[model samples]
Target: MTTIKASCPSCGDVELTPHQVRLVVCSVKSWSYYAFICTTCHEEVRKPAGRDVVALLISGGVVAEPWNVPAEVLEEHEGPTLNYDDVLDFALWLEQADLLAAAAAAQGPRPRAQAPETAA
Candidate 1:
């Protein structure tokens, strides 16, 4: 069996093992799928990817997208996920992306909400 080591970011322990598959079932949804989880810690490693798939794309570290992306397009462009070092890189990239997104949003759409005009 192939093994990889990772430090547990949550507990500051160097006991995390290489990727392993875990099946999760939600109470509300019966759909189940295997996810890569930390071997030692057992925390779903895919949590970050699921939470912010778009941000991961902007950060250029959409790790989980490759396996999940359709096969036909895989030959053209493949998305590799972040390793430990890649996580650091992702942070910097996301920071820049967030700034750009914010700037664009500020310059573009503005919502207008007005209460009904009250009679004097």
Candidate 2:
């Protein structure tokens, strides 16, 4: 029966119950957020929730949802970004490539192909 006060962009202030609010706690702290529909405007409002805000919302009877993000997704990479053409080329190559043979080859060491002799 707790009344939570929130603000709407169009309507200044509105009240909500704990059940009306959603709190998501992400593995990446900065990505944690809370969302709720504005009681006045009926629009959904989402805002980043820091540690303090998270704790407060929980104490106010809102249940916190856990979000586990993969570590690989957070990894930083340095390289040229792939474009549509690059993807198309890879797709075309894959269509002609022997995937089963490739997988079998990957299981063991294969002899390196010798380069053809070139005239000096």
Candidate 3:
């Protein structure tokens, strides 16, 4: 198997095979990132991949995964801009409600069924 050399923050220089590195390409901003599991420290490492680096990784046979921004996030919003005050207000309000319980509440209560017609 082909080996690719990469630097691990904790372990300095390390060699990883093509199968060890995974490439993540972001379509939104033409950005790419490399993710790998460091062998020496057994830690997950991720770093931005520039154009030249991306080409090198691709040449090494690493799998490339493309990602794009969600459609909902692209939609325009007209809401007021949030500020520190808003965050403080929310924090205060959150304390009043059982936030966790409310979030865990079931979908909603079903409407009561209508009584069958009774002939007098």
Top-TM-score structure, candidate number: 2
Q: List the residue pairs that clash in candidate 1.
A: 63-81
Ranking by lDDT: 2, 3, 1
- Segments of candidate 2 deviating more than 4 angstroms: 98-120
lDDT of each: 0.47, 0.93, 0.86
Best lDDT among the predictions, by candidate number: 2
Model 3 CA lDDT for position 4: 97
Candidate 1, residue 89: Cα displacement in angstroms equals 0.5
Shift in Å, residue 82, candidate 2: 1.7
Question: What TM-score, over all chains together, does every model reach?
Answer: 0.24, 0.75, 0.60
RMSD of candidate 3 to true structure, Å? 7.3
Ranking by TM-score: 2, 3, 1
- Kindly list the per-residue Cα lDDT of model 3 for residues 1-120, writing each as its tens digit: 778999999999999998899998887645679989999999999999987888899999988888887889778989898999999999988876666656657556668999999999
Indicate the TM-score of model 1: 0.24
lDDT of 1 by residue, 1-104 (tens): 33333344564433322234333333223232334555466665543323233333324322222233345644665588558998899899999999999999
Steric clashes per prediction: 1, 0, 0
